[model samples]
Target: MPVGSITRGTTNTNRLRRVDRWIAEQPALRHAADPFVVDLGFGASAVTTFELAARLIRSRPDVEVLGLEIDPARVRTAREQLDRTRAGDGHFPAGLPVTFGLGGFEVPTPDARRPAVIRAFNVLRQYDEAQVDEAWRRMSARLAPGGLVVEGTCDELGRVSSWVGVTAEGPRTFTISLRRSGLERPSIVAERLPKALIHRNVPGERIHELLATLDRAWRVHAPMSVYGGSQRWIAAVATLRHEGWPVIGGPRRSRLGELTLPWDAVAPV
Candidate 1:
C-alpha cells in the first residue's frame, strides 16, 4: 500500500514547465547512471509527467519518467492516458519514455531501483509542517547515490513557484521561479512556497526576511524595468548578492526570474 493520503489531484497542462526546466539542469539527472526520474503525486493528469519526460529526453535521451500517485484511481486514470499516448493518439510522441504507478513519499520503485530524481510538487502542501522532515527523510532515503528530490509548490497557472532541493544530506537549496512578465513582486511566490517554508513566511522568519528583501530589491531596481523584467530581476538578484545573501547563479538564471540561495539562508528559524 502507498504510504500517504490522497491529495486534491488538481493539475493542469504545462503547469510544471518552470520546474521541469530547472530539473533538466540538475547534475543528478544529467549524470545519473540510470536516468530514472519519478513524478510523485502527479495529480489528476499525466500531462505534466509526459512533459517532464519530453523536456528531459531532449538532454538525456535515455531518460525515463514514472508518474506516481497515492490514489489508485488517479493511477488508473494516468495509465489510461498513457495508453492513448502509447497508441499515438495523444499529443506526446508515441515513444515517450514514461509510465504511471501507485506510490507515495516512500517512492516505491521496480526491481529495487532507486530514482535519480524525485519530483514531489504540491504533495506535501496537504501534510502538516511537523510532518515535513519525516516526509523529506522518507523521500530522500529512496534516492540513488547523488540523487535529488525536488519538492515544492506552484500556482495553478505555474506562474509563481518555489521549491527546495533535498538530497540524502538534507535540504541543500531554496529556489523561487516566477514568470517575469506582469509579475508584481518577487514576494508573490510566498503563497506558493513548498510546505516546509510556506508557513514560515511570517514576521521574524528567515523566509519572510528573504521575500521582504527580494521585494525591496526589486522595487529599488524598478528603473531597470524599461529594459525588461528580465533586467530588473537580474539587478534585484545582484543587489541580494551584494548584500551578502549567499545567492547563487548569475544574470543568466536571474533573467529567468529565478533566485536560488543556500537552504540555510531561508531555513525556518
Candidate 2:
C-alpha cells in the first residue's frame, strides 16, 4: 500500500534530536542483529537524518541509517549533498555512515529487507487521527520482528516532544522528551505529542487523563520549584508512577528530561 501522501516537507537539523535520542535508547534498536533506521519524510534538508545517523551510531555504531524523502527533488538534493560531502575529503563532517533514498511510508527498497527502526518524526502531524492507526500498522508491518516504528513530533527548536514506539504487534511505549529547564510544566508536552494523541488530549481519552494526572502531580510537587524545573519534573513523574502509570525506565533517561511509560497507562480511551 502507498499508505499516505507526502507531508509539507519541513525540517531542521535538530528538529528530531529528541526522538532520535530515544531511538538510541530503545532496546528494539540496541538489541537488533542488523539495525537499519529509516528517516521517513526527511523533507527539504537531510541534515536531521545525518544527525540521526550520528546519534544512533553512538548507541549502535554498526547501525545503518537511510534518509527517505517522498519528494524526488528532495532526495536528489540530499544525494547530491551527500555526494559532495563524501567526494570532498576523507573526513565527512559527522563521520557516521548514511544513505539517502526516494521513498514514502511504504519504505521502498529493491533489496526487500525490513527496517529495524523507522523514525517518522513530524511526518504525521498533518494527518487525521483516523489515518494514524493505518499508518502505524503499515509502517510497523515493515519492521523486522522485534524492530520498532517511532513516530513523533517536536517544537520547531527541538525543545519539547513526545513519541510512540510501535512494534509489529502494536504500540509498546510512549516517551516524552523536553528541555527540562525550558518547560513550564510536564504537561507542555501535550502540544508536541503525536497526532494520534494530541487531539485525544481531552476529557475522556487515556492520553487526556495522563496529561491531567501529570498536571496535578506537577502542582503537588510545586515545592520542588525551589530546586528548579528539572527537579520539579522529576518529582512530578515520580508521583505519576506512584499513582500507577506503569513508569519503566530509570534515571538514565529521566536525567535527560524523559519519561517512558508502558503503553497501557496511556492507551486510547
lDDT of 2 by residue, 1-269 (tens): 34467788777767888788778878889999888888898888888888888788889989998888777789899888788777764235634678988777788764987889998989899899888998898888889889999988988889988989889999988988888775566788888888878887888888888888987987888888789877887888888888888887865677678888877777777
What is the lDDT of every predicted structure here?
0.92, 0.83
The top-ranked prediction according to lDDT is 1
User: Model 2, poorest ten-residue lDDT window?
Assistant: 87-96
Off by over 4 Å in 2: 1-3, 88-95
lDDT of 1 by residue, 8-125 (tens): 9899998999999999988999999999999999998888999999999987999999999999899999999999988899799999999888898889888978999999998999
TM-score of each: 0.98, 0.93
Residue-pair clashes, model 2 = 0
Candidate 1: Cα lDDT at 18: 91
